[model samples]
Target: MTTQNDAASALLDTSSQPTNLRIAGDWTLANYKALKAQTEALVGHYDGNTSVDLSQLGALDTAGASLLVELLGAQRLGQLAETATHLPAASRALLQTVYCSLQDFCVPEKQPEQSTGVQVLARIGSAVDTLWQDTKALLGFIGLILETLVRVLLHPKRWRMTSVVAHIEQTGLNAAPIVGLLTFLVGAVVAFLGATVLASFGATIFTVDLVAFSFLREFAVLLTAILMAGRTASAFTAQIGSMKANEEIDAIRTLGLDPVEMLVLPRVLALLIALPLLTFLAMLCGIVGGGVVCAVSLDISPAMFISLLQSDIGVQHFLVGLVKAPFFAFLIAAIGCLEGFKVSGSAESVGAHTTSSVVQSIFVVIVLDAAAALFFMEMGW
Candidate 1:
């Protein structure tokens, strides 16, 4: 019998047909490094048929039992059953426990190598699949919103007037100053560029018409929608996402309340009312800014700028721009709420979906604006 101070050792006897492997000494964590190296070396010399003799093992523990199991493959445990019966009760129990624990151990299969071209194609396929899934999800969400809107319309009592008013204050009234300021600055820049370009051809007088036409027909609505996509959409996502993360949305549903009617409809209605007003404000500020730039840089008086705009630009341009506002507002609000509903119960999920809402809303607004422009051009509007 070996004491606790004796290091673990294994001896192999290959004189017989099936080799005998003898284990002795303190087979505990204290001698783990030496046991590990010795076990690994012994693995090459043994096979499934080898008979293990653990009867002489001293100071056996879980760690040493695990190494012994590794030296004698777990699959070969049956061959050592009779040998284990001759071991001390403690050593036998340790070996039995380790063997049973490692019985389910399996080597992971290696992935096959792929060529660079194949890998690139695989990534492209995955991206396309993801895009398709996103499109389907968005369409499904739009359908759900439409259904909820119809239900709310049928039930006048379901109209969340207070919530709608609050959102209008949040998404519309609070946003007006920044919207006006940004458009005003953009208008000044457009006027400066137009004045510079037109002066080269001795057509500086047309700069007023350029700014008015661009702002009234496209820039005003497009800029307002993009701003809302970033500002309002992200805000909507964060608001609803927080509610979801806090389990408040779940609690609402548990009480038999439709979250769509309570949360989404109010925001949508607010944006529908607000965007057109904001677009009108943007158009007014932009035109005012352009007129200021014209008066200062092109030697054109405010009177002359107004006269030029009245004579050259049509009312149809402003109408065309304002008509797209409601559509842009609906989509931005829908995307924001949809992404918010997607948020799982985590702060990280709320942040991720909020960012996704902004990106998707911006992308959709731009694409729809471009499509509308093409359609109007084709119709000769």
Candidate 2:
């Protein structure tokens, strides 16, 4: 046993040819602190041809072997296996093992700097790739929902009527006040802006037609869908995401229950039933708001406003907006549930996916609405 005062040490003899370095004493944890400092100081002095003589080294351990390997470099340490065959069997074997393990090691190369234009192009390419992946995933999720829906329809006994009703109340009934209020305010603002602009051309009386046309054809349904996207979609993601995080979804699968049918179907059915009804309510509230604004600001009587609305704005405009509700509902529900299923058993994942669900649902609704409007216009509908 080497005493603390006689701890491990290394002697570098540059006076000798090939710069012979001798290591002696117990190279174990008890002497590691002193050994480490001595070994590190000697490392920079040694070259590839430097000879390491470990014949006198005593009581070697993994810690000491690693320190010696670090000092000699793995290649030089490997050469010692044959040249210093007089070393203890355990020490020589440990050195060889460490050297072999480190033989093929390499430092990672630094990334090259990219020009601004190249960076911008790279970012664009990455965004496009991500969008493509998301589109494929969404399409796959939609297919799963459709398949589950078909299975449920075929076996009417699997219908979750109670869950559907509860979700309808949550998504539709609970969401009505905010949706109605937002659309009403928007309608009032549109009416005020219309009256102000038209008054310049002495066409203030046309403000009623402006409000009716805009709300019936675009604002009511668009605002309602956007509201549902933000509110209902986030709710769906959080609810389902929590289930996923808790492994309740996994347990459902283990019991031979389809998570899509039990969880997703009810939400989808509820939204389908709720969105059209909500769109109609929004349209009525918005028109009423516009009518109120006309009476108050433009001095148009209620009867006159209604007469103008009835005479100028056709029911076809109302039908056009209402027709988009089911599509928007399906997409919003699908996106929310899809994001929920993407949760990775973390609170952060739930929050992140919930936000994604809202953004995607709103984006899909707006894009689909624009496409629908263009199609209708092209067909002169």
Candidate 3:
């Protein structure tokens, strides 16, 4: 209550058999530090026989009242406030309030430590729950995409040819050079390594068969899909996420437009058409690269490499790789667009969801490819 610079004092007389604790001076915030120090110095005098005299106590505020309650202890606060006829009504009320509040306060209990096994189990359970949720989301999105696709297909006028063509240029044509270059380099490496290992057994010529079978059956589509996942998927997520963050998506919805149709369909259709073409291009590029390496390193002419591939590699190998393209493309495009729609209207949300899209697309492509490969192998394809 008082703003005066008067330092509060708590005096104790330990000379008598019973301690006498006296409080005096302005007990406001400004004197809190001094008063605290004084009380702390006389803490040893707190015993059952101690008697408090607050008659000389000056102005009091909540902060000082709190300190007084602490010095008197909760057990004696109520009784002292009631008996202290010299203390002002406001001061006594404040002391009682602080004392009651402090008595009711409780510190939260610390959690017990878990055993290693318990921690591990908790982590596994959490992972399973997350996986289940993700699976449900992906499946639901897929159904939504399928429904929209069917509706569009039924209405020829609803076809987004311009958007589809534009997206194809962006996702496929623009991507061809990098795809070709990577597959060519990887094919060369595969051919060279195969020749080196085969030479030990005097079968280096069979390197052509190794490269042909590997690239046509696995490398071409797998590599193309993985690249698209990282490159094209991230682009789709970022573009859609940016649009969503800018409220363009909401505007589209308000205008009676389906965002999935306006934004997602073109991208999905374009990828569907583009990925198969890219996979085919990848196959041709890979074989040529292997042929080049064979012509240079093994002294096997290009014609000879072609002849070997024609005889040793069957059409089924090519079909096996190309068949996986549509599935991969669908998943990659869907996952990318799905993540974009999930952005929470922030730059950081856009970034996090973009990264998540890439990871999910790549993982799905690889897993589906593996399962397809296993099915083919089991069926003697």
Runs in model 2 with CA error above 4 Å? 1-6, 12-20, 25-67, 79-97, 111-115
Please report how far candidate 2 places residue 256 from its true position, in Å.
1.5
Poorest lDDT segment (10 consecutive residues) of candidate 1: 1-10
* Residue-level lDDT for 175 in candidate 2: 88
Clashing pairs in 3: none
Steric clash pairs (candidate 2): none
Tens-digit per-residue lDDT, 16-39, candidate 2: 898888888888988889888787
TM-scores for candidates 1 onward, in order: 0.88, 0.85, 0.81
Of models 1 and 2, which has the larger lDDT?
Answer: 2
Task: Give model 3 RMSD, 1 decimal.
Answer: 4.8
Displacement of residue 178 (Cα, Å) in model 3 is 1.6
Candidate 3 C-alpha lDDT tens digits along 1-381: 111224678777666657677778888999888777766766655775788778888899987887776777876877887889778888888878877887789998999999999999999999999889988998999999999999999999999999999999999999999999999999999999999999999999999999999989899999999999999999999999999999999999999999999899999999999999999999999998899999999999998998988898889999999999999999999999999998989999999999999999999999999999999999988
Instruction: Tell me, by lDDT, which candidate is best.
Output: 3
**After superposition, candidate 1 runs with Cα above 4 Å error:** 1-22, 37-51, 56-62, 78-103
RMSD of each: 3.2, 3.9, 4.8
Tens digits of per-residue lDDT for model 1 on 1-381? Answer: 121224668888888768888888888999998888787777678777777677777888878877776877665653564466766776666666677767766788999999999999999999899879888988898798889999889989888999999999999999999999999999999999999999999999999998998999899999999999999999999999999999999999999999998999999999999999999999999999999999998899999988988888889898999999999999999999999999998999999999999999999999999999999999978
